[model samples]
Structure formats: structure tokens, C-alpha cells
Target: MNATATFDPFSPDAGTHQGGALDGHALVQGDYGTAVLGYDLASQVLRDKRFQNSALRLMEEFGITAGPVHDFRARSIIMLEGDPHLRLRVPLARFMSPVTVRNTRDVLRRIVESINADLDDSAPVDFYRGVAQRIPSLVYCHLAGAPASDAPQVQSLSERTLSLLTRDRSLTPVIVEAYDELFAYLAGLIARKRAEGLGDDMLSYLISLGDEGKLTEQEVLTEATSMLEASSVNTAHQVGLVVWTLLRDREAWQRIVADPELIPAAVVESLRLFPRTGVVSKIAVEDVELEGTVIPKGSDVHVAVWSANRDPGRFERPEEFDLDRERNQPLTFSTGSHNCLGQGLAKAEMEEVVRHLAEHYPDARVVEDATRIGQAGGRWLVDRLTVHMKP
Candidate 1:
């Protein structure tokens, strides 16, 4: 738990200092044939600024854009920047606001209660799939106006999308097949909601957006499909990682279980340790310079969120999962113009599930290696996280 870890730029593993904590800046040493040779704090910040919704230009570099928009492209508000950013963000902000999350807690609490009901003291079970992994999917089911029957299918497709990021290109058709099926299924729900009108729920609220704003039938379909995909994939991945990290550190679990209020703090702490997205990319709109490296015009660069969260320069005992660490809200959710809009709902969901598990099953221990699905920039996985409850 050293506070003064020094990053060695010349080492074989420059990403980690002498210690294993990630120093993101040290990893980009011009080896990738880019304009810049190393990290440039000021320059990287400028690169995140979009001159003309140009972040999509980076995705085009990866070639996922050739697929139909039905593929759940990250090109939603996530990839938008500049003028398009303002235009797109305003409408979406209505649903994602803090107030909406506050109003949704009663439903979230019921979900936590229902998921925890599966816990049995007889023998160990995969706490993740039997419980942790399914909660977020249900959250989206309620949000998308889809039935609970859709949970397993939704979970599978979300994981498939995550894995497609890391697998051989040949496997893409398999991945797309899942994406297309999920989209088709959601499309049916969209049509039903339109005919049936808004139910007393979150998903219905989104459908009601069709009346007041510029939301087209296709845009509604597009937004709902993408939101459900993102809601399940990211939220579950994070919560699973949080549980895995806590089980890896028994002391932390013990402390939080003793005081359920600390569950929120533990979620923040776990996110700092195990980021869902390993790195975030931004394209440079113009040439920039920092740290004696000149990043020429039209270059793309990545800020390793996973790496930065662990940098010793920015945190004390950077390798330890210290819930009490008084650092800023870690970059697990990104920051600036592109921070997670669902942050409020995600936090509430995490807080509820973690609180229930800690308070009710204080001695539950992870019984298998958690499986993770990931991509080039990052990945997410959770499998075989069996847990045993104390008698």
C-alpha cells in the first residue's frame, strides 16, 4: 500500500509502476504508430472535444458502422460530440435526470427483494447468475416495458456483445445474430407500448416521449433498443465486478455488512478498483502537444479509465480497495460531456442490491471464478460466482 509509486517509462510493463497499480499515461509510449508518443494531459483533454460529432469517426476506424443501426451502435449520445451532442443530449436528459431516479426507488427496492428471495442456505449457488446478474436485467425489463420472460435472453445477448469485442472477427456474425434477435424482440414491445399506451412505469414514460417531442417512431425504437442493451450489460457487469472485488477482500465485506449504509461507498470503492470499461477513446480534432510529444491532427487516442483509476499519483494506496479513500468519484462512469446519464439509476440499483446482500447474507462467499466478457478497449464477464451462506 505504498503512496509514492513511481512509473517507469522504459520498463517492459510501463503501464504498471514498480507496483502493479496502473499508470495509464505510461502505457502509450508511441509504439502503436500514432502521432503522439506518450501521455499528454492537456492535449488528451482537448482531443475529447468534438469539432463536429467526430467521435463517430473513431468507430468508423474500427468498422462496426457497416452493420445496420439495429446493431446497438455506441453512436448514440455516447459517441456524439459538439453541436450534435447538445441536440441529442437535451431530449435524452429528460428521462435520465436525477429526479427520475429518485422516483424509481420503490420499484428498485422490490426488485432487490425478489432477487434475494432465491438465496438458499442448503448449498452454494452461483450468486451472480442466480441473483447479482439478473437484477439489472429486470431493471431494464421494467424500463423497456418488456416482460420478465425476457431476462435470460437479454442477459445472454448483452454478454455476447461484450465478448464480441475480444473474439476473432469470424465470430462477429454469431454476435450480430444475437443483436438482431434482441432488437427484433424489443421492436415488438415498442409496437405494443404504442398501441396500449403508457403503463405505470419507466419504459412507458419513455414511450410517452413520442407525444411531446421530435421523437420519431424509428428514433424511439432506436433509443429503447440501445438503452435496454446498455442498461443490462453495463450495470450487471459493474455489480458483478463489485461483488467479486468484495469477496476477494473479506474485510471490506465484513465492514460494510456491519453497516449497510456503507454499501454505496463500497460500490464506489469497487468501481475504482475494477472498471467496466478498461479504456475510453477520443479523436483529436486538431494537432496538440503535451509532455514533449506532439499529437498531430486527426489522431485517435485512448485514456485508460481502468488504468487512470489506479494511478498512484491520483490516489493513496492505489492498489488497495479503500472505501474510505476521499478521492473524487472515480472515472468508472467517465466524466465531462460523456459521463453515464444513467448514473443515478445505476447507483440506486447497486445500493439496493448490495445493501440487501450485505445485511441479509453477511457471510455469503463467492465459490467460483467469475467469468468475464470483454472487448479491445474493455470487457465484462460474470459466471460461476457461487456463494455459500453462513448457517
Candidate 2:
């Protein structure tokens, strides 16, 4: 179940069944050195002050020393540590906090309803293309004060940029090429927004950082584009995953549709069962011992998020998907200071779609089985999710 052996996190027995390789270890040696698979230990690695993301080190590993892509990674709040991370994250978090998300709920609901209304249920409709991919990208564009017309461009570039992190080496050139176009597009948008004065939007918030002397022009550009890229890609794919999972079970789908109140719990359970990001990458800064395993300093640590979410120790019948589970807590978003600041927004986006599908297309079902794009550690991603909305 180590990284070297190539395990699919989406497989039925990944962490649920007894005697599985991944389930047998607190820490297992893998291609990335030591991997923490146990729920408790994985949580420790994520929250521990001794562990940090090696973005610069990763750039070296990927042989991306200097470029727009490299520059973005270096300045990214998600990649920074200590004060630097906090400095950028605090203001950005305020803009995307629960209150902000609640304010935007009406806008998000309208977007979802508008998109779902156009879906033709007569034939197999590609949910990935028609709905999942567009919603978050458009919403992000609107929130950033960018034109809604820019969504298609954002979708293309963000998806390609994310390919940089995939295990597929062939996508490196695609990623590099994407950075060129993405950087130029975002830079132009930043310039225009700057010339026009600020607005009540996320991009305006970043521009204000420059005005306040808290962030430089380049820092503002990098952070704004990075947030756009991450939020769209992460939230879009997650919506697809949740839809695919729910459609696979008629009874579960009916239960949620029958009671709209269950949409939130259903979304939560989907996240637990099929976390969008399968692994949280980290590097140990110093020697650390946890659960009887000692991880030396400078070792690459891959926290198995998918496995940890399904750990039998914390969850009863961890293999099963139950929306009504009385007590459920999953580390799908990781923990501690680095926990997803966009969770509130992500949840609202997800819940909106789920609620729409339940209320509008209660009889919808998967027209064809979803297919995985590749054999990467994350297999929950549905390359093509076609659903047929038949009454």
C-alpha cells in the first residue's frame, strides 16, 4: 500500500477492508520515503509545527527553477510557512469567510439554477462539461470582478496549471506553456483593475493589499491568480465527485432528494468517502516520533488523506457511505493552521449544486459509468460524468 507499489485511493478496499496493505500501517515506506497512513498520525503530520510544504524543493524536483510558474509557487500563500503564510492568508480568509460566503449565497444559487436549467436530460449529458466545470470558474470570475465571459479561459488554464502537480511527467510542458498564457491573462486583468479603482470583490481585496503597502504588485498578481486557479480546480472536481457518488446509489440519492435538509450531510459524506485531494504533501523539518515511528528530518512525508478519512478506528463502518451518521469528522480538508480557508465557500458551492439536483432532477441517474482519467494516487476524479435526467 506504499507509494512505490501504486495503490488507487478510489479502489473499494483502499483503506476500508481488513488486511489491506494501506490499512496495516501507521507509517509505510514508499517512493516518497515514509508515508503516514493512520488517521491519527496523518493529522499529527498536517498540524505539527515541525512539518512544512517544500514548494521550492518541489520546484527543484520538477526542474522548474525560474519562470512565471516558479515565481507563483514561491510567492504562493499555500506554499509559504510561518509569518509569511499567515500574513497573506489572514486578509484573504476574511474575504472568503463564512459571512462573505453567506452573502454570496444568493448569487451562487442563481448561477446553479441557471446552469442546471439548460441541461438537456433527453440524452447523456456530460455533467463535467455542462455544469461542474463552469459553475465554480464563473462564480470565481464574478467574485474576482472579472467578467463572466472569462470563465472558459480560466477553466482551460487552471486545469492545465494543476496538471503540474500530477504524477504524470508528460504534462510538465503543458503546465509550463499554460503558465505563460495564464500569467499574461491575469496580469492584464490586474492592470485593468488597478487603473479602474477597487470594487467589492476578491481581486479588489488583493489590489488593496498593494495600496496598503502590505503586498507588492507582483505578490498581488501571484496571490490573486493562485487563488483563482486553486479554488476553481479544487471545487469543480469536487462537485463532479459528489455528483458521481450520489448517482451511484439510488436509495441514498432518493433520501437526500426527499429531504433537502440532508444535502449538507450528503456532501460531507461524499467528501469523506472521496476526498478531492488524495494526499497532503509535507517535509519533516526535524526528527519526529509519532505512534512508534521516527521520521528523520528532511524526509519526504506523504500524508495519506484518503486512507486517513476512512480509518476504521475513528469511523464505524468506514467503508459505507451514510449521510445520517450521528457523529462524523473527516480530515478531507486537512487540519490546523493550514486547513482550507475556502471551506465555507467550497461547501456553499457544493451544497447549491446538490440541492439543485435533488429538487430539480430527482430522477437523474448516471447514464454511463464514470471513468478515471489515470492511475494516479487520486482516482476519485471523473474524467467524464454523464448523467441522464429521466422522469
Q: Write the per-residue lDDT of candidate 1 for residues 4-69, one digit (tens) a residue.
A: 224322233434332222333343433432221122342245245642233345434445577764
RMSD of 2: 2.9
Clashes of 2: 0
By summed lDDT, the worst window of 10 consecutive residues in model 2 runs over 1-10
Which segments of candidate 2 are over 4 A away from where they belong?
A: 1-24, 369-375
TM-score, every prediction:
0.82, 0.92
Q: For candidate 1, what is the TM-score?
A: 0.82
Sliding window of 10 residues with minimal summed lDDT for model 1: 33-42
Model 1, which residues run further than 4 Å from truth? 1-27, 30-47, 50-67, 70-75, 200-202, 368-380
Each prediction's Cα lDDT score? Answer: 0.63, 0.78
Candidate 2 per-residue C-alpha lDDT over 1-391 given as tens digits, one digit per residue, 9 for 90 to 100: 2233344343445544331135355677745567666688788789898988765566656777887688788778867878988888888888888888989899999999888788777777888888998998888888899998998888888888887656566677787888888888888888898798779899898888889998888878877877866768878888988888898888999999888899889999998888888778788889987656677899878777887777787777878889888677788888888888788888889999988888878998886654443225543566878888673
